[model samples]
Target: MVRNHSEDRTESIILPDGKIDLFLFLDDGVNFEIFIGGICNKPIVKHPFPKSVMFAISFYPMAAEYVFKRSFSDFLNKKIILPPGYMGFYREDMQNFEGFYRKACVTMQRIVTDPIDTRKVKLFDLINRSKGETKVEAIASEIGWSSREINRYFRKWLGITLKTYIDIIKFCNSLKQVKSGHFYPELSYADQSHFIRTVKKFSGTRPTVLGKNENDRFIQLTTLSDD
Candidate 1:
């Protein structure tokens, strides 16, 4: 959860790691709104209300299929407002973040009752095990599939090609290092220049600027916590 303390300001959402998010926004006037957000490959800006509280659940790339019963590509780079009565089944106090999280977990457990997709599970496991360093060809070879076939599966289920997903995972891993004050040269990128350029591309700001922003810190916290 996040609470903004200043005047309404535009926040840049950097989701270099692919995800689908569910958000609940509670403004100062005590009105609540909920939205389902899809995969984002680039930075997006939104103005949030002052003193607003937001609770969000970031879903794994593969979980979208089980949770929503739709192809992940269908909601790519999109946000859809849920119906007004969507939260009626839960009776938790909205002000309690932990309570809200418990309610969300219960709801998700009920919705995700379908059998697991073993292929997708193995793919996700392989990518994570390699720490985003494995090449697409290597992954495909290990999985006994052609590169083209692997890419097709990724696009059909995750709304992005395999290469893009790998890039996002690498970028997010490097971002965590940057946030931890371990911005050493030759650590993740080729050099300092390459690091700065990649960070700017994914976050819409250079490393220095991103590190100094309070809102960005919160964003990083949320991203890291999801992992």
Candidate 2:
């Protein structure tokens, strides 16, 4: 179930999963995510947080955007005081949670970590799409700007350069097909090796840990963080 209200907060329920939920802040690029790890359910008092969030259960690689966008990190770092409900991602907005508890929590997590506004998705989408095509500079030119300007803009908002984003996208594109049985009947060993190498050069980890979907995979909150 998906719902968007006048408040610009958008949320929905995807197929149930034990460990994850992706929530998007609609009309805004800001994403709030909630990750359910382990079984710790003890209520946490609202507190500040500061630190890049770990991408998932596995820690083979780390992302600055993943951890830094978290407002919880700010709270933890004493950057600000959060109301009781806004401590960690899990602790925020529990009272108003009408349903989909897990998903709701995930949304809250994204709330803390939203890096760019909603409109920025287009830029990312384009960059991701470019993975299957030509050089980054050429892609930039086709998109309207010189490679330098594009890279500069991307870095200003994404914290990583456009080159890194492209790497992440291309890597994920290759890994996704492989992981989804795309290779079951067709991909050659050479094909697999190339994909792994490409992904490793950018992510320092392969599909197992840093696969594209491994982050906030749902359309609502999916993003390709820098390598």
Candidate 3:
């Protein structure tokens, strides 16, 4: 979860990070609104409330299906208002950060009692293990499914093409290296030019600018701490 105390802002670009987010907006320490965010294939410009507190839960790709109990394609590149009672007991503790987190975990644990899709789980593991360089055909072969079938599953569950998801994973890995002040040429891209282009495509900024961005720091910190 992430808590942001906004002062004043007009618009900002939200870069793709290959995950779904659920946001709970609090205004004057009261529950104001709730939204469910989906996978973003490209950078998006958003205008948020100038002065408000925001708490967001960034769900991993594999956990989204269990948490929402729906296909991600329904919310691709969009934010939908959560239905009333969807948060269960968590709604009562929205004002307390720690209490809210505990309640959220309980809600998730209860909902995720159902079995997960093993093929999708394995596909995510394959991408992470290969650092997003795994071949699509290889995944299909291992999962005993045709490439077309695998692509369909990816589109429905991830809200993006398989290739785009791979690119996002690769970009995230490369970003970690960049933030740590170490770029290994052989591990990430074909060349420095390729790296710059890929970063700009997803993040709408050059590597240097991205490295210095506070939003990027928040995303990295929250993502790492989530586990």
**Candidate topping lDDT:** 3
Q: For residues 1-227, could you state the per-residue lDDT of candidate 1 as single tens digits? A: 77777775665464556778878887774777878788777776665578777778888877877887777676677788886557442223457888887877888888888899777788878887766767888888787778898788878876788988876777777766666666654344678888788777777777776656565533653456424
Clashes of each: 0, 22, 0
lDDT of each: 0.72, 0.37, 0.73
Query: Where is model 1 more than 4 Å wrong at Cα?
Result: 6-12, 87-93, 185-188, 214-218, 221-227
Model 2 residue 135 lDDT? 63
Which of candidates 1 and 2 reaches a greater lDDT? 1
TM-score of each: 0.84, 0.39, 0.83
lDDT of 2 by residue, 1-227 (tens): 23332342233112111111222111222334443222111112222222212122211012223433431211211222223223243433332344335654474466455464433444555654554334676666565667787666554533445565555445445544544535321322246667666544543445454434442333212332233
- Which ranges of candidate 3 are over 4 A from the true structure? 4-6, 48-51, 89-91, 181-186, 214-227
Weakest lDDT window of 10 consecutive positions for candidate 1: 84-93
Model 2 lDDT, residue 88, Cα: 42
Per-residue alpha-carbon lDDT of model 3 for 29-80, expressed as tens digits? Answer: 6557778888987777766554566678888788988887789786778888
What lDDT is obtained when candidate 2 is compared to the true structure?
Answer: 0.37
Q: What is the model-wide C-alpha lDDT for candidate 3? A: 0.73
